[model samples]
Target: MNRLRFAPIPAGLPATVPFTGPETLERRSGAPFRARLGANENGFGPSPRAIRAMADAAAGVWKYGDPDNHDLRHALATHHGIAPENIMLGEGIDGLLGLLVRLTVSPGDRVVTSDGAYPTFNYHVAGFGGQLVKVPYRDDAEDPDALIRAADEVGARLVYLANPDNPMGSWHPGHRIRAMLDNLPEPGLLVLDEAYAEFAPDDAIPRIDPNDDRAIRFRTFSKAYGMAGARIGYAIGPAELIAGFDRIRNHFGINRIAQAGALAALQDQDWLNHIRAEVAAARARIAEIADENGLTALPSATNFVAIDCRRDGAFARALLDALAVRGIFARMPGVAPMDRCIRVSCGPAEELDAFAGALPAALRAIL
Candidate 1:
């Protein structure tokens, strides 16, 4: 008789997850946070049209989603001025990253990313048994030269970079990215994450050839559309590269209701513009609050503001803990230099008021 064996999972499994959601913070604290300002999510919520569409599709929730993501893909294609064949919808950028890794990376392959950049990409690479070579950020932005050098040095199969980066919120102009695109090596995929492109300034998003196979750009309804919970994101690239995703992706992973909502949301361009204005105002207010507290808030093209803590990671972490205890959910950077700051997401006026009210006490408690 064979006894139940307790062998462990493979050692290649990542020791840590890419990032923790704000729900985990609430669970750990054993209390609901008053101001949910972490996670860089748009607290403004999704378009009213999207909500109505989701509500209308509620009865169909039991049905499986379209495997081809047909309606949504066509709508996205129209939105991006590309053919449907050039677009591939995924559960979210997270799920897409996993599938991309599976499609391109083999065990022991090399991947390149910016040091202290998005952790989710690293998480996917590690899960696929790929070695990650990280390049340090230059002036708080992903350095194109350094990334190209690292990719060349390691003979990387893929390189990941988030324009208008997380934590730092700095971005390179679109023209700069276009110039660097020509330098990228062959047989290597550039995973350009443009999750925050809507928030970035004009000329910050490059216009690449829709048929460009050397790079694939990722966009999500999660950020500016304020539908992070909906988990809808799409990748735009060469039809062949985009088509390759179907071989390994969970075809029905994007839910029926989510697809309906995303379709409506895409059609509501006025609402998106309104939210963009709201986000800009919130960013200004956050910078004001930071200045009032004698802290320097970094200029941001993303929804959140990163406030330099004036000390080290220890101080930034202590401030984060204090803010959390004071019912304000905030997060800090995970590495040195950059880690000396705390990140706070833009929210409604009341939530910002809560953060402003808690600032002094939290600082005192931490210091």
Candidate 2:
């Protein structure tokens, strides 16, 4: 047998996964997780209208989705008060991010991000042969000033920022972000990932111009709309930048059902508000749980809460492992300091109850 040739870039890259899904863990343990709180999924579920839309669209699976994503984009435009031309739909924020990297990053081009930020963005940058320059998080939040300085120093083509951040679940005010954008080095594009925007405080999101060429914002149905399984998301930016995605994106990657479901989801703001209130209550409950367990819960602007174990990363990892052993799945930041906390997503009462019941025993086993 003859071996196939590999590209030098890909050959040099290590094979790695950004996340180990609960299903994989379930398979490994030979048991299902009693509480699926590891992933930041909206376990409260989607709007009834969205469910019906998906079910209705199912019969049309024989046909490919609109390559242009016309209806969904137009709907989203109306929802955000932006022109349809400013929107570009993709499989998810993950897919759109890859396209953005492809569109901007050349081999060895620099990209800037927080060291403990979203790994998926880093994965995409690596996949595209971009040199990633990381800055440590400041006070458990993404430091805009530090990020801008790093990007300027490294002459970065892109700088990634996640508002209402994952893992640690900390965030900065919108005015701070606006200041960062104003000072960003010329030619460096800001990739503002607002995947959890629906869960954030109103003041947390900056009022950047949708047509701003200096930045592009990524949003997803996965978080608030409970459409993670649909793999539907979109990017909003200047019309010119948005059009660039058409060159490299999978034209028909978004399925018809997902498109239909997303449209319906956008039209149902009442459901989104309901989910917000429920998530707020759940966050409070999670804080109470952490307090009862002798831990501190970091203030979160997202669907998840990061509980500080008053120990080191090792202790948090042990606690997470123990929780898994107890059939409760949770996750922690991959790096130090931040890893002193385990991240838990908001869900319905029963799931939280499962997590609550498992916490004490896990703590005893670990401590």
Candidate 3:
């Protein structure tokens, strides 16, 4: 009789997940959250066309998804004005990060990222036994130069940066990002997570050049397109580098329904623009709510806003717990300094109203 055993890394690591879903939390609390905003999901929902397309694809669930992701890949290539060879579809940006780590990061290889940039990327690095060298955030944003410097200093195999970063919702302008791409240490690839790119200003988005070897940009339908459940995203970069993903990528990982939804969502530029406008208004409202309570809301280029709690991490955590108790699902950064802010996702006016009604009471309870 033999008990189950795993590889050395899995055998030694604790059972920890990057995120605990709202459903699980609701189950424990005995009630669903009033405003589900913690996950940074697009609450306005996907395009009606996308929803219909997904429904249409539902009948084909019995069949395997196109392993090549051919049609969708060509669609994204057209959307970005790049060649299809430069694009590779994956389960999501999260999956792409995992695949990138697997492709480039041998155990004990150095990886660089901002201290609180994106925990899931860090999660991937850890799972793959890569040594992470974290640089601190500069003014609540991912410091591009600092990340590049760290990568060069450590001779890193990978450097991760999320433009208009998560948790903090801060962003750097395009020129600076282009500089980072140009100056990124050789032999070390840049993993640019643009999950929230649709919400950003024109100046905040860097140009996508398929021939650029310095970075591979990952974009998803989860945020602005309101398809978080779709689990579809695409990566654009040098054709050869893009092809490397074939070595280890899950051939049929992307589902048929998700593929259809993402393709429809991409073609619906009108819907994407509408979402951008809605997100912008919601960001302003979140900032306004923070101001009404005498807290400061940082400028955001993403679908969420980060309101400064005006105190330490302990207070922020207390405030977050209070929000949870009030059935509001806001989240916060998990580290020092940056942890003094709470992140609220952009949602419908009604959900934002629920948040506004809960904010004062939650703050007072924590106080």
Candidate 4:
């Protein structure tokens, strides 16, 4: 270890990007993927209104984004039935999570989460020198009771839970979540990631107060809005806690174009409804394809499916590799038990066709 270090946490931690993006894979192979399905991006894409707004806003790129994120925050407040003071905006949920860690986590602070949860949150915790207490998932779904139990035992200050969770794509009902919150011990702040809530049933999202002092819920425009590149996300929390973000947040982090596009996307509910139908159809197709190839596709509320390879992590990895070799970009969970499945993002019929066509061949090679 270096005697004179600026940030000791980063100095000791491995330098890595949590997720290997599709473009990076393409560059390494010197060939582009046939179907981009690894990242759970909306293949249906943003609404026409959003696209037009972005194009219009693009001309004003010279101006900085609203530091306070006023208009968008107000619009979101109206949409969510909350006060403007209760919200905070950032580049993305990932960025906002980092800020939350930076603000709340001192050296050695304990953070609790599921064993095979969103790795990005773990990455942020590590960066801030927080100790993560991970609990195991119950039957491929994130276990709220188990997580709460671990948090209380550890006397954790923070707990991360992704509703309509990533990778596994399973979620519990709102009542279970509310009960989890009710049982969470004092000062154990909950980081509720609702990135895929738009795709989930309404009952999956808890009806929590916007000013719940013990929780901050995050939402993003990247998934259902199909604007992952825009990097627009926001969090709802207690007014006082939301104000604290002003102290350390990158005020102008969200670009001008992204803000306009997000607002327009929010207005076009019809387009969102259409995308939902498309995602539903694609999910069915994915299940059908998996059944045809003698595989089991887990029921998903998120914009992706985790198909069980009926084997170990190595087998699932081999299947992913086979799919990659066939020019289909896909991914798998990193931790065990959950890692026995490969994640496939929901997309349009054409993209799903590519995945459907590649699955049997990929399986044959791996098997």
Candidate 5:
């Protein structure tokens, strides 16, 4: 080898990044967005108590956070009626996903997820040199049985399912999902992403043994708690698997201010209830807007609605582009069938008003 030569990057690395943030899009467009409803962020925002707690914790920024996450772990355990040993906290579900991928995946190892599900998990799996095998959604909802069969056939190291899924906002009853899981082949872990659980029905959440070693559940304060910026998320699973995180994770990743915010957010049940009501109202309004625009809105179990563009993927893409050009931020699924719909997150009235005002112009320009 030449002395001047340097090591090259891996040949199998992905050529494209997963997503571009809204800010990046704005910078490219040279116009600020009037509505920020594409990201599924709660525009209603965090609870007053959470704000106060974060403000109080701001003074302690000079010190490093507790590596064990002692207080937050204990608080979460008491809240969920599970032992702290069963809990694993991380920067967010995104970081935890990377840790799990490292723990389970090897070069060329098989991993299963829905074709158009969360892309971040797939990114992590690919980063670890795992092969991703995806199953398509049936009627906009993940075909759980099909995914399980695929996982078994491939001897998958991980199976990813997002309840009340992103982009589509579709969900199956918890019992139905549980039935599928009961028949799922062992020797593989089922990673259930419950990021939007709080917005779903009470029965939408599966009842699982947190001590079960075969599976893990991921939850986030980002979605329902209005703490997306806080970067707080957690995993619930068997003590052994939960402990695996400590070995790979950045121990003090969760900042003290975030912990304080999340704790207060969790305690403010009334604020959460209010936000839920607001989301429900926003969903209904979105449905009405869709109907008025000669489209149909899918039944949603999360803080977003998927409106059928009533056409092919190209038409949907055109519509989305039109919306973006008009300063309305929105998104759609990555594949066909689902891609025929545009996903819009529920937000405050002003944001919805922006969407409503722009729909007709977007449709006219695109159609």
Candidate 6:
């Protein structure tokens, strides 16, 4: 019997997801996590206004979301002081990245990123048959110089960087990022993932020309805005590059509720400021907890903290597993020496108390 055939590209790809959701873990363990802190989601949740917006929009579920995402895109443009033509909305940064990889990468095309950077981006590159070139992180931060050099050396079509980076919770200042972009080789597009930009300092976020075609910056409502479940994000780039996303993106991928929630969330700057303060306090509390456990918490600009277990990756993994068994869900980086640290997201007092209480026992168990 003949079997259905897949395209050569997809047929050769591995069946894998970049992340295993917390719900999947709970199912496998046959228990709920006492503190859900592993996924970097905003446990604080979106603003009451955003919540109300979603509820108000729920009645319109019978109608599809605006395929053009006109209102949200225009709102985002106004928020960023750019023209609507310079923005493109998608399900999330993850979804937008896939579309970007699709638009720019072809079979055997070269792409560059820091080793152990955002794995989802790498996954997309691999799925599209793009050759990935990885530069090692320098001192736990993405080495911009090395990345630029690698892109030039490989004649890469795209390069990826995340400011206030994930897993390790490190960051590069805005000017340095600008220098990296300036030095990027001709024909290479910089994919700057600023999903955590809201949590970063103003100086760390570079000012880019809205009409500049050298880079495309991706932002999401998922992090500081507390709209991860809504699956709404947008990209900022030159009009020409932004227009390319429409060619391949899922036209109606963003639902009405998501668009409403995101729009409402964007309008609530006061709420965003409140969340920022809350996250800052939570980070401090996490650091204090780490100190109590004789661990060092790295300084973070994002909503999560990476606590150095002060040992090898094996030790960190053992401790992370011990915490999981105790019903406190947390995560560690997938690669070393970053893996020597365990990452915990900022949460309210109650959720963090669960972590603070479980950590000592988890460490003792690992020892």
- Across residues 233-296, which tens digit of lDDT does each residue of candidate 5 receive? 9999999999988889998788889999988998998999999999999999999999999999
- Tens digits of per-residue lDDT for model 3, 153-190: 99988988888799888888889889897898888888
The TM-score values for the models, in the order shown, are 0.96, 0.99, 0.98, 0.98, 0.96, 0.98
lDDT of 2 at 365: 97
Residue 252 lDDT (model 6): 78
Candidate models: Cα lDDT each: 0.88, 0.93, 0.90, 0.92, 0.90, 0.93
lDDT winner between 1 and 5, please give it.
5
| Ten contiguous residues minimizing lDDT sum, candidate 2 | 1-10
| Model 3 TM-score on a 0 to 1 scale | 0.98
lDDT of 6 by residue, 134-224 (tens): 9998888889999999999999999999998997788999999999888999889999999999999999999999788899999999999
Q: Which segments of candidate 5 are over 4 A away from where they belong?
A: 1-11
Please give, for residues 1-367, the per-residue lDDT of candidate 1 as tens digits: 2465433334547467666777888899899889999988889888999999999999989999999989989989888889999999998898888889989999889999988998888888888788899999887778989998888888889989899898798899988788668878866778999999999997899999879878899999899998998999999989998989988888778989999999999999899898899999999999999999999999899999999878999999999889988899988888888998999999999999999999989998877
On a 0 to 100 scale, what is the lDDT of residue 364 in model 1? 86
lDDT score of residue 188 within candidate 3: 87
| Candidate 1 segments whose C-alpha is farther than 4 A from its true place | 1-9
Q: Tell me each candidate's RMSD, in Å, in order.
A: 1.8, 0.9, 1.2, 1.3, 1.8, 0.9
Give candidate 4's error at residue 147 in angstroms: 0.7
- Which candidate has the highest lDDT of all? 2
